[model samples]
Target: MKGIQHQLDLAFGENAVTVSRKAIDAGEQNLVLTANTRGAALKVFDGGATETGASKLFGGNLTASVSASVSNTSKAGTDAIHNTLDTNTKLTDLTDVDGNKLGLTAGNVINISGTQNGNAFSASITVKDNSSVSDIMNAMRNLDAFKGATVALDASNGKFVVKGANGQDKDISNLNFNAQKSSTDTTAVASFNKMFGGFTETQKAQDASSDNSLSMQIGANQGQTLAVDINDMGTKALRIQDVDVSTAKGAQSAISVINNAIESVSAERSKLGAYQNRLEHTINNLGTSSENLTASESRIRDVDMAKEMMEFQKNNILSQAAQAMLAQANQQPQGVLQLLR
Candidate 1:
């Protein structure tokens, strides 16, 4: 409604801003209104005491129904478009119990998968080149994501550079690029570079596409999380031993925990959907009502430019005739002078 009003202000004026604040003033207004309780809606003014100004909403009600008020004539403009178009995120992000993120990679990746011991969690990721060393260090430093995993470089000989100092057996899934940045640019990289649309580099850089990856490992049992192995470049898979639960019930219990967590997340999403629906319905009704009211107002108050133009033209002719008559009047006075002469 704000958006519509804004547009109307831009096109017409703030008198276009429609607000429905139909409240029954407690003592200020009174008139015997026809009992028309149709559709839980009470349109058709009852002339009932001028409504004392729209009824108030109860404590639990969200927003009270009000009539559109053309409060300001200059306040409508295009800036209110955003009010009509709302983008809301209703769901919580998908994360592990400890909130570990598995995100898209910019360039090629060499991943390492592994399991955990008593306190030490280990995994190794392979990088396409030594350029990944800094990236590896950075990921390791970010303990907030992979809370249980401590990352370091394993001894490298010639062809193989090892990661995962704690000895967690992790599989390697490396993302491969076609040769250069233009071949495979990702959003993460583009954001730093500000590629408006897709991954297309404005500047050219050689060897930018060369693959670089960092192997990583996290907790042994950070709860049952489904592992998604990312593989694009030449990479190998690393597997972990199945969790050893002594009894079937123990395993089922873990599964149940995972299920419950998933369900909770789903419930939150459902709530968001409901909220969005309710808002959308309200906005829809408001928009329709505003439009109808605005059209009606234009009919009532707005001067038709075309009609005004015609009126002005007629008045212009009359003025011209009046000027001619005044000249004739002056000639009559001259006649009096002639008689005196």
Candidate 2:
């Protein structure tokens, strides 16, 4: 219930709608919602998603849902590909199945061709030294087809193995190998086949589970969004929906389940708190910008009454001085007229 309210506030602005849980009876509680404004309306739909704010608030469904869970089905992965060459023996001294040493020298190329992770690729591994199986395994890892796949030696089987990364499904197919003849070694292809041709698949590949996460736009602009992966908080998800607490053992089990539910809820609350803090900071920055812009607008549009009044008084004084000078000149002209008479 708190999750719903937090999502609402995050969607419709803070405090737009308040949701409160109140006890109606001894064992029942009612969820009460009070809208502080008339614009807040939550519309519940039947299908997948809608453009309404309510659809996004509820994670594009009728109810707030948990993240898409990975199917607990058996993990699908690629068959382990390995070579029969003894891991303890060096490539130069490695013996064939006939118990004869290969006597391979440097510059012998082991042509590896396979499709890893659905991409077809081929490469030649130049024998750096007959040192260890890692020379070949490491070289295989550098291939683009095996970019994210694993290539290692299986100690239990003494065979070099390759698998998908993190147990995910890897499409490895059309695997083949050949040895190219070099000037230093004419029998390189025959020696390479005798030592490395025993590669086989120990396991088959399978697919991974699907994800059920929903993407929600929290901000007004593009890319200002987050993926909401709410864990199912209902009794079924908490493992307490069908649990009976009538017996002592049942009650004990219920305690454990409830504790787990509390932890889950606490984790969700922590995420909500972080999101709220971030939104609050964004709102504060926007508010500060609004205040600064308003102050600038006032400075441009508002009049300075004191400054204007001072300019008016100075202009009035200049006009009076000019009138006084004109009056003095007129008096002098009148006196000259009297002298002429």
Top of the candidates by TM-score: 2
- Per-residue alpha-carbon lDDT of candidate 1 for residues 1-341, written as tens digits (9 for 90 to 100): 46544543332122312323344665333221121111111222442212222121111111122233332121111111111111121111111111222222334332322222322323323323233334544443353323333333222210122233233333322211111132334223222122111222111111111133222222235332222223332111111112224656445433433444456556666765765676566578668888998998888665676688889999999999999999999999899999999
Give stretches of model 1 more than 4 Å off: 1-249, 300-318, 333-341
lDDT of 2 by residue, 1-341 (tens): 56766775654334545566566678755455554432324432223333222221101122122111121111111121122444555766665322445555666777777765556777766665655566667667887766676666655445445665544556677656556556455454665564445443322343211232444455668666555456677765554454455766556535645666688789988987887787778788778888999998887655566678789999999999999999998999899999999
- How does model 2 fare in lDDT? 0.54
> Backbone collision count in every prediction?
36, 6
Q: Candidate 1, residue 284: CA error in Å?
A: 1.9
Worst 10 residues of 2 by lDDT: 71-80
Residue 255 lDDT in model 1? 49
Predictions: Cα RMSD each:
35.3, 24.2
lDDT of 1 at 226: 24
For model 1, what is the alpha-carbon lDDT of residue 35? 14
